[model samples]
Target chain A: EVKLLQSTDVTGGTFTLLLIGMIGTAVLLFLGTGWVSRKWKLPVALAGIVAMLAAAYYWQAREVWLTAGQMPVIYRYIDWLITVPIQVLALYFFIGTVARPPTGLFWRLLVVAIVMILARYMGEVGFMHPTLGFLIGIVGWLYILGEVYFGKLGEINTKSASETVQTGFFWLRLVVTIGWAIYPLCYFIGSFAGGVDEGTLSIVYNLADFINQILFGLIILYAAAKESATAR
Target chain B: EVKLLQSTDVTGGTFTLLLIGMIGTAVLLFLGTGWVSRKWKLPVALAGIVAMLAAAYYWQAREVWLTAGQMPVIYRYIDWLITVPIQVLALYFFIGTVARPPTGLFWRLLVVAIVMILARYMGEVGFMHPTLGFLIGIVGWLYILGEVYFGKLGEINTKSASETVQTGFFWLRLVVTIGWAIYPLCYFIGSFAGGVDEGTLSIVYNLADFINQILFGLIILYAAAKESATAR
Candidate 1:
């Protein structure tokens, strides 16, 4: 049997931190929608929805971590499976205001994002060779980065007249780049390093998500509010 | 070691049913908000929010039920802990439109509702004696019934002038009385009786929630839509 690290005060504290951050951010995004212009409302609200879903998943995660004294891998993946696509789509909605996205851009990004998550999940669960899954997952993430930063969407975003939109797109893209990179790094260390325990990985994962998920939405909200103020 | 029922096709299918019901209802309630008037919008949308939260919880519950083949009682209570209060508040919001609810009515009902869920939860988890917990839970439920049925809120309902609100109040109270009874019945069977398996109790609980959660919201939506159409 694989040995699991029992929960310590630190891990439990981290989970609580995650829980509060997600719920607080979710409520903020939802309430913040009223302050933004109509066009920005959907993206902001979608982020709120994603945060709400994450908050619910973490509710169970915190309970399991504290009570069962082990991480349930399924909770993390299930959370990503639902929330990640919505986060990606929040970006789609954010840009739809300033630029007409190319045909198939939405579907392509969604499919790739799902594949990225599925690849990592299959690897973690031993359904595929870990190295192969990691490679496929990385490829999927890189494709997304290319699409948002250098591909057709990126071209549209560059050509768009709205400075607010352009600035927001830059930060959102950077988050998907640098902020999301934590996932693969965690995967590598947790699965391949053979030294770190689950508790450490859990805390690291929680912190990464707390930053990425909330920061992604905050960038959009900032742009939306700025745009709204200028328009008014 | 406690024996766990191996997941079968039937149990798996039931979980899928629960998952689909929750998500579908959540989406429906959310989208249905546009059809209601501004006064009724919060309560209708609050129901949607509740359904959304329920969908997230069921997603996790179904995963554990299908894979672990055992009920995680904590998932049920965690779901209730958050969703139940919002649901109670939904009723409070609904009645606020038609009647000036008495002072302390909201807090009293909310506290009793929390007490009800906590008592049963503690009983299930062995934090307290099961019979004593069961009795406290029953007492809490009865107090809520009294508050809504014959206490100040119910008295206001009887004196209300709006036919739609009065009719809606009648059905909503029935749900609280008859629909919510499923919990105590399930708790009694699962805890006190020695015969029923966890699988059986899970199926019962899922079905009960699928009905209670959706039906509670639908009744509000129906009344709100009717009132909106008539007023317009």
Candidate 2:
């Protein structure tokens, strides 16, 4: 009998709080982008959004800010936190591509948006079906690789020093994409073909999840750094 | 105690055969697109790839071709069937976008490519986390709606004289996305509010799955029609 494992009460509560914090941060960033875009400029505003999301993710993980299962009211909001921003960013990119926006922040924001969304969603759901999540990771990396290979990444631009500069995060994007790609390949092949035991599967899944979350955090950091450097 | 649903030892030989037949037909249509492109002088080859993937998905759910436990295998191949063509199309589109291929197939193909990939993976993995899959569906549809609103759909050249060119069985996309969205919404609200019953959850899950599969089959039919139309 395959007994369904009930999600831990503590984890569920923590999940809720993390989600609420993430969503609240996303909303603040969205508004901040609008204000900052009108004042300091768009690149700086976009950078702010990336920085805020990254900070929210870090805060969610911090023991000081978050206690396990202490808040159940926030998980539903967290789920949206992980999903809505990605969709918004992707849509923004798609529309930009068609409309030919003056600033090429579209694709960069699209990738960052997707990475953040996936990181948060994976935090919530990746453990549920490790194999499938691994597969999706491969697919996501491949999609990003295709974009980079085709020079689509260059289409995105940053407003720096009153000039539209092409400050694409080549190395950071490459590392993050490669990291996600390899992590999944290792786990899926190890478990599916090697016939690794369940214990190993669990370990690998948690490790991969942790690594993915870290990479996501790093990607955001790189995006902010790249933005600031370009501004200089 | 949640007893495991005992699966009958039904010979899935027929289902397997049907799946192969569908794959074979889809492959042929996929290949047929290449030949048609050459004959029609369509500036790009992605149209064929799209045709092929749509065919595979639409044919995937032939009632005669699936059974219990057989789904995972059927879905695995189906995933490849849809994914490979989309990736190829995306690569070509990326090249076109950067290289300035005479045809404007990049944006439209990109949309279809990503959506196809998402649909394939979501169908396979969404079963485990019904809520997550539903959320993906809503996000995807909203993205598509954004595209439609931006007139991106109209830009896709169906390569046929017909005004109403069917693109895969988007109905499956509609059903799965809508169904999954409803499931998660219900689960989150009910789980949090503590008002929904298990029986309701089970019924919603089963119904969504059934609708998703049925729509999948319909998509295959649409793919076939698309092939025939374009072939003419």
Candidate 3:
């Protein structure tokens, strides 16, 4: 039988260091990407997703590390509220960087992100029944997920774009689809059984953010590099 | 401010009749469609989705009508457990009925339906926190929606198939995507607000099943007939 592992203060320190390393790496990459291709939108937006996520993660990690005993759950939600929406915007920029961007896509994506993030926040903060708030949030995530994989990214995948563009879109969408799914799975794990406690949840979340925020950024960087190389 | 609408016993009778009417229609349509197209798989699967949904709805309606005051929520989950998996099959048949069906498509779709439906049941049954259940279900749903719209249906839409096949998939997919979203929305609404009682939820559910089951079947019938005409 699988059991939930209770993390100790030592493990907490290790995770905090990891979080700092993630943030420092993200900042360095963001600055480097910005310098490499300020002219391109995708890389800039990719940098933006990492920037906010790193900030959120770093801040939360510090707060949790400094405090003793059980960490405050609200810190995680605060990090998510600040970073998750920005991540959605990064996805938006993926489509927008292409010429003749779809009309109303930006606002629509933003609305979904805001609704999802806020509804979840409300639930976490006890403004409503957690389940119902979560349901609303799920509804919002469904809308964004539908538009991303089914609607926009599909268009990008099948369009008459060049080989490099198509390759970039294919890999980018794959990364987003696969990597982002881990967040919710981890969420379910945390919420479902008595086995996984807050500390493990934090570790898993921090690790996931490291991948989703940074590894996700790697795809766009490659794409931007390809785009810039051809232009020069 | 929006408030949840409570339903009364008198209204309950009307919805019970509606449920019976829905079941009766689905039965009649199933018989008629079975006679019309035994050779085709899509219509058969469409018939199956309706047949189970009608039976589940019919059983639940009878119990509620007889019991008067209290309702067992498990009946609804039972219904979903039986019907939703079939509904996924209906979606698969939409693509499966086409020439050169994709590899491993059936198992993937089944896995998604099972994951989605079971997670929902666990949440409703209080076996797990509803939020985690909802998230897992959403994950399943997003996967299915992605495949149906962006992945497979898009392929069905663009391929050099006969006009009849394309039209069938077009209408089928639209009905599935738009019509199915409402069930989750209503579910969230019912779960979120105390004002909307189970009766109103049942009424809305019966009404939606009619559209989703019978009305959805009608489209498949047209497509089946068209397929038959071309076959001859």
Ranking by lDDT: 1, 3, 2
Q: Between candidates 2 and 3, name the one with more favorable TM-score.
A: 3
The 10-residue segment of model 2 chain A with minimum total lDDT is A1-10
Clashing pairs in 3: A4-A195
List iRMS for all predictions: 6.4, 16.5, 22.1
The predicted structure with the larger TM-score, 1 or 3, is 1
Q: What TM-score does chain B get in every candidate?
A: 0.91, 0.38, 0.82
Mark the regions of model 2 whose C-alpha exceeds 4 Å error after superposition.
Answer: A3-232, B1-141, B148-151, B157-160, B167-177, B229-232
Arranged by DockQ with the best first, the candidates are 1, 2, 3
**Which candidate number would show the highest TM-score if scored against the true structure?**
1
* Candidate 1, A104-127: lDDT as tens digits: 988888888888887776776677
- Candidate rank order under TM-score: 1, 3, 2
Candidate 3 C-alpha lDDT tens digits along A84-163: 67777776665555654576887787777777767767877788877777788778877877776678755755673667
DockQ for candidate 3: 0.01
DockQ of each: 0.04, 0.01, 0.01
The window of 10 residues in a row where model 3 chain A has the poorest summed lDDT is A1-10
lDDT per residue for candidate 2 within A1-232, as digits (tens), equals 1111122222322322333323323332343332222223333334335434543543444322234422221332353355334433432342232234435545554655466436534644644465555455456556555554443443443322322222224443554465455455544565467855433443343344333333333333334433434544
Q: Write the per-residue lDDT of candidate 1 for residues B1-232, one digit (tens) a residue.
A: 1112222244544565556456645754674576567888888888888888887887777778767777666788988987888888888888887766866888887888888888878887899987988999899888888888888878877888889989999999998888899888987776667658877788788778866788898789878877876886
Clashing residue pairs for model 1: none
